[model samples]
Target: MKYIVCFSGGHSSALCAIECVRKVGKENVVLLNHNISEEVEDKDIKRFKQEIADYLGIKITYANMEGWEYKTPLRVCKELGGFKFGNGPALCTYNLKTKPFYKWLRDNFPIEKGSIRDDVRIIYGFDKNEPSRIQRRIGVMINQGYKCEFPLAFWDRTITCTEEIGIARPNTYKLFKHANCKGCLKSGKQQWYLTYCLYPELWEEAKQVENEIGYSIIKGSFLEELEPKFARMKCKGIVPTEKIKPQTFWAMVRKEIPDKSENLPCECAL
Candidate 1:
């Protein structure tokens, strides 16, 4: 009997929450947030989550990933393999987000993972502009046998009916182009360049982690190889056609920049 809205306080997610409130009333709409501490620093996501809740006058709950309180995407990259999601699901998305939130739902509501809970409808923040992203998520939900809804599916603008009251924007909105992870391992070389240019300390910390754990954050290229401009070209094609130690392989990777497309962030990065 709960209407969960994935509230990230971003343009699309925030608007979607407001729409949910309008449809189901504030009492039924619960703002479910997955707050990433942004690794190297605090992004102050709490402040924005509060703004969204206050503006909508809805119930807000912060979900946490058990045993992963200190784990960021960068920190998880060094565990076994490099920063590749592989052909299967990305562990970071499951560990950092989906697992904790769904566990909360099952504990409070009358629903389970595989069973279709007709009473519980999850509301997503996808807009009409991104049709493919919307459908992709819908397909995943269908396969999982979960009931979901997109309240903003037909909406096009960032400012919705609820934001008409003149609520202030979050300060962290200016930190990145998107309101996702700060130094996400899924980021491409161009994104890595932006991360280095915008937050060198975060970028440097990732490199230090890579060197310490003997695994690059990216699949083939290490963070140290994330060069600017022409450096992007050098970081690619580092894995030679021979077997070598992980540390030696990453060291060799730093000798050249990777192709811009090689490390592009996947949809789950958001």
Candidate 2:
């Protein structure tokens, strides 16, 4: 059976691809990479894609969203009205990622008339830790007449050797375990704070997008409104230089809050 694995050029998605290749073999698997406008300018993102492509030896199908363009949650909020709590960046996901993914699936692999082979399953690389996100993905797939599987979800539930090592070797310990867009609105203030310190250019770009759209991804606060507040709260957080290591940040976040698995309200971006 043919399987299409959605690739966001992030670690989670890469892990998902690796697992799929392990299960389905590389030939029957396709790496469907979405080329959202923001992502197009990211050199690190491009490198990630290349790394995955070289490692997998699978052709990456770069797909654009056609008429759809990158719009932050702030943009959507502005179009709808003023930004409010839980507005802006959240809505951006639906337009740029989820909706585009659905559209691509419809155009390339129709659901009706048994268009997809019966054995086909869409695999998402949501780690075992993110149950809410997995559930949401499953819900969306069901609505689209597809089945979803989460290999990492089960793995993430149990403590591992890696965790033991990470605990002992704190500096060696990687922070920030989850993977998605660098400035994804779903990411909390800490993550955004790290992004601001590490990739100031991208962070500034995100701010510009928010300003241009005249909304804030963080609902009640615009970037301009939130920046001063973020500046005031100072911590000896690791200042990322040059490259932002995704794995390191994931580990750091996980370390700070061991039981932070609760789902925030879906910002309707996805």
- The candidate that achieves the highest TM-score relative to the unseen native structure: 1
- What ranges in model 1 sit over 4 Å off? 38-44, 67-69, 79-81, 110-114, 155-163, 212-215, 218-220, 228-270
Q: How displaced is residue 128 in candidate 2, in Å?
A: 2.3
Best of the candidates, lDDT: 1
Question: lDDT for each of the candidates?
Answer: 0.64, 0.59
Q: Looking at candidate 1, what is the lDDT of residue 145?
A: 52
| Model 1 lDDT, residue 155, Cα | 37
Global lDDT for candidate 2?
0.59
RMSD of candidate 2 to the truth, in angstroms, is 9.9
RMSD each, Å? 10.0, 9.9
Cα lDDT tens digits for candidate 2, 1-270? 767777776665667777677676998888888665554234556666666666778988866645445544434445555433453334556656666777877787788863433666777767767889988888867777788777567533332222232312112114344434556566656567756655676677768777766656665656665454344332324454313665765466456433333122222323
